[model samples]
Target: MSNEPVSVGDKAPDFSLQASRGRTVSSAELSGRPYLLYFYPKADTPGCTTQACGIQEALPALGRLNLTVIGVSPDPVSKIDKFADKYGLEFPLASDPEHELADRYGTWVEKSMYGRTYFGMERSSFLIGADGHIKAIWRKVKPADHVALVEKAAAEL
Candidate 1:
């Protein structure tokens, strides 16, 4: 990986992963279009569900801005399928079980909880512009406020 960390002005890293419901997406295909790439820790968890549903609720408005949203997590395809079905999420939920994409975006980091330290995806969001450059970045995002922020950013895109 390059030494650069993803930031507002840097080019977004490339990725190709399997999305839920047998759909797949690649950064190559998303090129020339603005999109939101969100990295979460796991599937079917409280925070993850809230974030996904929040995005779900904002889909219509985001569409008006011509922005696409794809969620990434270190979960398997089956788990992502269950998550999407349970929550009725219409957006693509990409599987990143190996943390390949997370590493590229620098979202994977050391986390500590209750004195237990571990490495995991650090709930982050990236807004990639139509020119393939990152327009904005939100690291360690709060789920409750994520969607509205995304909506606002998209509208201005």
Candidate 2:
């Protein structure tokens, strides 16, 4: 993948991934409408949990704005299922264990923590418009600030 992340106005990459509750989500099916693809580092961890739960709480508002939300992670489907079940998250949590989607989106990135460096998913979100072009992009996002930012962007979209 290029060092540059997918930017606003770029066409979103296609994906078909397994999700919680034995569901499948694909870019094809989500076409002709706006959607939010939020990538997190892992499932069920502190920040991830906070972000997921916050988004879960705001689902009604987001749906009212006609924005579909999908949380993507490098976790397996089984782990995603568990995370969703544990938190009662109604939205799809897609598994990206192979990072195909992340690579295309540029969220799978090099990171560092605790004096160590590694590659991982950056906390990011992309708002894709009905025409399939990206409308907004948020990278290295804070979990607490995600929903409000997305809400504002989706409303404007």
Candidate 3:
């Protein structure tokens, strides 16, 4: 399989995943509108929680920008649901349990930690334009500063 990553100006890949909102969130559904598609390592983890809550805190600004946010991870739908419910996350948290969306987005890769290696989803974010093309990308995102970066990008978009 080609490991080429998704880049700015490429058409966003199509996906259909079960989301925490109890329905499928597909690319088609989000078409014709600019949205932030963010990928994290897992649901309910410390870093992921901080990233998610950061976005939640910025929802007012995001809404004013006319943008929607969707967070994707390789966790099961149940886990995503619990995370959202527990944290009162207003955005949809999509389940990518089989890594279909992660693979399609090229965020699933071999990662090394403490001299051990394994495959996992990289923390990344993609800004998709109204026309469905990527406008910006944040690969290996830092949770602490992700929302601010997205806010900047969204303002430019």
lDDT tens per residue, model 1, 1-157: 4324677888888889999999999999998999999999999999999999999999998999999999999999999999999999999999998888898899888899999999889999999999999988998999999998888887888
TM-scores for candidates 1 onward, in order: 0.96, 0.97, 0.97
| Candidate 3 TM-score, true structure as reference | 0.97
- lDDT against the true structure, per candidate, is 0.91, 0.94, 0.92
Q: Report the Cα lDDT for residue 69, model 3.
A: 95
Q: Candidate 2 on 82-128: residue-level lDDT in tens?
A: 99999999999999998889999988888989999999999999999
Which portions of model 3 show Cα errors greater than 4 Å? Answer: none
In angstroms, the error of model 1 at 86 is 0.4
| Better candidate number, 2 or 3, judged by lDDT | 2
Off by over 4 Å in 1: 1-4
Better of 1 and 2 by lDDT: 2
The candidates, ranked best first by TM-score, are 2, 3, 1
Worst 10 residues of 3 by lDDT: 1-10
Instruction: For model 1, name the residue pairs that clash.
Output: none
Q: Worst lDDT window (10 residues) for model 2? A: 1-10
- The count of backbone overlaps in candidate 2 is 0
Q: Candidate 3's residue-wise lDDT over 76-133, tens digit each? A: 8898989999999989999988888888789999999999999999999999999999
Kindly report which residue pairs in candidate 3 clash with one another. none
